[model samples]
Target: MLQSLTGVEKHNIEKKQAKALFESTLWSDAQTIGVTISRGFEWDTKHIIESGWEQGKQMVVPKCNPEEKSMQFYRLNDFQQLETVYFGLQEPKPSATEAVSPDQIDLLLVPGLLFNTNGYRLGFGGGYYDRFLANFKGNTIMVASQQQKCESIPVEAFDRPVQYVLTEEGMKQSK
Candidate 1:
């Protein structure tokens, strides 16, 4: 019973933590770093979009070929250019154009239902970002509410770990 109550308390704490971190550091830091959109994460990309534009940092979103199970990224010059798609998450349309390579990104903002301090994450399990992240060497961060924290997450060989966990409260180091 005590454990159950503690879990509930932790859940609430994480939610507030996620919000506070954005208001404090992550948003401002994006001015210089490029962030990759994770379609349907719990974050309000509208703020991220506006902040990215205001800061003049290139904002990129993931584009995946479902059957291919692989992912690539594209830069959106403005938030107005983004539109709602398959998952109800806003994304920039590929207009007969290409995007910058993985190595070019300064940071990656990932979405997940759960994340651990160990850098483990459980995404939609599509393996899109998981596969792409394997080749990425830049700042990889996950923005999850506190409730999403787990003691440990199950990881497979192909699943990669993030470098940072930015919750609403503050920044938690992963690596």
Candidate 2:
């Protein structure tokens, strides 16, 4: 459904979702945030990254190691610190950025293709986020458009539910 959105429609929805997130206490209270640089079909996170910088909050992006099926986050001070990697994903250049411990992140913005009200998500199938969440102690949240919401998703033993889901309509604590 996300792929069907026109550029204008996606942009407007993304802006609204971002605005809702900004108004949430989670956004206001988090000092350090972890997020991914979005791809074309995903909700754009560039604004969120910039807003974190403008608010004096530390922003971090992940670099995935395909071999280990793991991810490490790095502090991203500027977009110039990123390099295009596999599948055209923008990842933090290890040489240009400082590594940030998972414990230091107050909130993590989880990515998903689809989600239910319960917070269970249908991720991109890499399981990187699932593995990372296994030990992560910080708050987890997912931002999606209303179109991305579904009645349910297939859950596995390893699946982890996010604490909250923010959409263009508003933010809701997952059941």
Candidate 3:
């Protein structure tokens, strides 16, 4: 359903969602943020990254190690610090960006295809975020559209729920 959205509609929804996130206390209080460089079909995150920079917040992005199925976040100062990797996913260049420890992040923007009221998400199969979330103690949130909301989704023992969900309408604390 996300992929079928018209370009204009998608842009509008993304803008509204981003604005809501920007107004959030979580965003305001956070000094360091962790986010992914969004893909074509995903909700645009470029604006959020730029907004973080404009606010003088430290923005970090993940670089996945496919072999270990793990990810490490790196501080991103410029778009030039990213390089395309498998499946055209943009990842931080370790050589150009400094690694940031998980505990150092003040907020983490979790990504998913669908989310339930409980905050559990149906993430991409890799389980990279799942592993990362296992030990992460900071605030975690996901930006999603109403269309991506579901009544329920299958949950596994290892799944970690986000604390909040931000949509075009506003932010909601997950059950």
Best by TM-score: 3
lDDT of 3 by residue, 1-175 (tens): 9999999999999889988898889999999999999998998888899999999999999999999999999999999999999999999999999999999999999999999999999998899999999999999999899889997689999999999999888999998
Judge candidate 1 at residue 123 and give its lDDT: 84
Q: Which residue pairs collide in model 2, if any?
A: none
lDDT of 2 by residue, 103-155 (tens): 99999999998999899999999999999999999999999987888876799
| lDDT (0 to 1) per candidate | 0.68, 0.94, 0.94
Model 3, which residues run further than 4 Å from truth? Answer: none
How do all models score by TM-score?
Answer: 0.76, 0.97, 0.98
Candidate 2 Cα errors over 4 Å, as ranges: none
**lDDT for residue 96 in candidate 3, whole number 0-100:** 97
RMSD (Å) of each candidate, 1 decimal = 5.2, 0.8, 0.7
